[model samples]
Target: MNRKRTALSAAAAGTTAGVVGLVLIAAPAGADTTPPALPETTAESLVASVLTTDVPALSGTVAVSSDLGLPIPGLPTGDEAARIYTDGEGKARVSLIEGDGEKTLVADGATTWLWSSADKSVVKYTGGARDKAGEEQRLTDPAAAAREFVTAMGDESTLSVDGTARVADRPVYQLVVTPKPSERTLLREVRISVDSETRVPLRLEVLANGSAAPALSLGFTEFTPGAQDASLFTFTPPAGAKVTDGNAEVGKHEPTEQQKQDLLNAIKPKVVGSGWDTVYVGTVPADLLESEVTTEDKGGREGGKTTGLDLVKQFGQPVSGAFGTGTVITTKVGTALVTDDGQVAVGAVPQQVLVDALGQK
Candidate 1:
């Protein structure tokens, strides 16, 4: 999807991680059920596939849809689609579908390049490094999303194979992963749809605890398996495009421990309750709107950025919580509360739940 690039949005949705425990619950668009349903595998095998599956080279269109009940500016909210190609090695490309122009990522195993069509800017990273934006530098596929979902879990998370269905026109096994009793995450369950033939996760969705809707969803709207053209992995910056050395320019200087603490204290909200009813208590930057999220202060591009905060101001509506009055942003997935005093609480439940969670504090 057009992922929100700001830290507050990340804190609002990310920080928790999934496949961020997928919440969307929808029968596959063209779901199919046939005999020999998945050869009876266990959660252990599915988890194994997430870690060990050797995804084959392929090319297709991926569509990520969101209803975060929040306003995300610059970044598309409803659907962020892209055409991707991978070599099954370390080479890949994603040509984003944007109206202004195309945004592409190409990795040739040695150095990766990001060319933004809208900006006509190219950022290059050598020795296989990440961008200043702190996004994955290497070729990351949809299966990696499933892997992240599984990898984020501890041994306590419960796992099960719900049944069989068709995703992206292929027969697949639906695996349900639930957080353990002790895990304090707000997520209730994550569903991953794995290709029965290849064990590749074609779709993923996360839901908040006791919630009926998916907080997030990522899936391929189109599919084409097998090797793609070799040229797709190649990259050459357009003549005269502003190219920055992504890795070198990123960490111009390191931060002191106190600066690190300041950042932590800035966004790190305490968890007041656990499971689906869980609430987070923290302080959003009083300067969320006024400050600059430079790379130096936040370290990660996601942090210290003001674009996302502006979106929050643009889209977030006012609401009162137990912590007192503030703003609330409602998405198809969950709710976020930022009080007048800068106290922040967010969860998948209703505003009242956050109020109750604040009361516990």
Candidate 2:
């Protein structure tokens, strides 16, 4: 088998509307005003409106805060900011602030660029080659995540309006998604802040079971909705920056578009189960795992016998079950399991749900 790296890695990073966020300063201690009146719609109607609402082209700053205690390398933690811009044509840009460095993502029509200021490296992709409009579309980011749950409501999840509040100084409705009694998940609720006038999702908060705080939160700290410049969606490698095609294979040839589609169709994973307890399973090639571990070793102490799971457990708790011993890593928003038999399961449910998922084979 010819080993090849597809553009799957870039799919998650592609749909970002390149919007960087600005930090808001606190107002005077005595400043106060009555919050706007609550919206006059039931949760179901509000959710329906949100799903069908087409957010206008605009640029704004978004804040992402996560307490998911995963040791996943390169996972951004704490309260970080990003500037997101969208042109209403599915073209968007995201500039992420990472301390003194920044990582920018610009997604044009059929191409995307990932640039890192720290390393001065650029990775270009050939767009979302998989079923992006389906399973993968929901993971675009936190703001989009709220829209996803709203669209996915009505069946496995119960939708209700948790009333209204002012977020980012705008009056909005709080749409909440609560898992049904039969749904096995750790999430207590997923709250979406929808701009009352625009019906666009302004923020999302994911709260774990029995937790008072959000495990994962994403929303605009400030928003200025309007037409964005055309330049935000375009990118050119800066002078002296290294560039690499995302679909470049190991051999001397580049994979054609048809080849990329074929590769995606070949390895397309299947989703087993439903609702919050869903599991994604696919047969990833051995070289993919090998390359992943090798990359990790390049950063850690040389000659460590540990593979990906070993390194993952260093930051998570050790877990074992009949589904075969593997580490279970839990974030504030969800939990995941990496089985010894090369099967992986992730969701907001507890570790046992993953064990059950691994047994489905």
Candidate 3:
């Protein structure tokens, strides 16, 4: 979930136009002086002008390099190229193809879906209200997107000054966007390049903070405006695909008290020996463990109980359950099953299997 959330936030922030403001700073030496004056524009006006521009539908290829402070534990460096398309209304789609595997994401005006070709699964998000509210907050609220621009130039963000350099042969306006100090992520500053003549943003660079790497850049290529079709926004679940509604209740199941105790016993040794001082356990996989059994909870009259398992631990590494493939993490006593909730679950998997899997490393 953290990985998914991070990717989605990065993608959304990358494509959204209203967060950053265009400001006219003095051009560097030997730049074109004939370009229009940039100082007269305000942040709000610049955002409005870009949003209202009637560009044709667009198609492009984008390359993204994600450095999450450290390398992904199991995956590669996480650099990949994706096909991207955007309509004039801020709707965008991105698809990544690698060998026989693919991942697709569509952000229509109202909803966003993340589709995994390998799993034949889709994660849907309703974004119409969210986008609108986010837009308003970005434009009007002091702590929203592009809050950095609000602090640096305030109302002057709308003013556009000619940039000193040309990217992709188009005249560029260097725009600086600053996120609020209290923003959720580590993003410190963003620099975007907007077309001087068309007022459309072409490129963006984000600078972060800490030992966690500081900078990541995204460049848009082969931009074509107003060329996308409306049908691209819709998605149909594939045949035999399992559908999960994110907004729905996660469902609950009841397990016997004895089964719960057995489950705790199975994981207790692993937790005690886990090097970490604190751990959170939730949603354990019960199928693989003999000591634990998952049964439906019959707490209420509506007795269609869902199946789930829970184990608590004070020390272990955080683990996620979203990975369809199970992962074993080393602990002080031995190895433990790290569940989808970043928790260590005892009896979620056989202790021997956990040790074997960890030993493979």
Model 2 alpha-carbon miss at residue 313, Å: 4.4
Quantify all predictions' global Cα lDDT against the true fold: 0.71, 0.71, 0.49
Give per-residue CA lDDT, model 3, range 1-361, as digits (tens).
Answer: 9999999998888766334422223434334555544445554565555555454466766554555443323322456566766675757677778668887777777766667778888766564333432332122111122334334434312334324346444556666565443332334455666656666666555565443442454555445445678788677767787655533322233466898898776544333222111122344344643244333333424433233333222223444333433445442222446544333434222344443333331
What TM-score do all the candidates reach, one by one? Answer: 0.72, 0.71, 0.41
The alpha-carbon deviation from the true structure for residue 300 of candidate 2, after best TM-score superposition, in angstroms, is: 7.5
Error of 2 at 130 (Å): 12
Clashes of each: 16, 15, 23
Worst 10 residues of 3 by lDDT: 136-145
Q: How close to the true structure is residue 231 of candidate 1, measured as C-alpha lDDT?
A: 90
The root-mean-square deviation over C-alpha atoms between each candidate and the true structure, in angstroms, is: 14.5, 15.2, 19.3
Minimal lDDT window, size 10, model 2: 16-25
Candidate 3 lands at a TM-score of 0.41
Task: Give the distance in Å from residue 48's predicted Cα in candidate 3 to where it truly belongs.
Answer: 7.4
lDDT of 2 by residue, 202-243 (tens): 889889887798888888777777898898889999999998
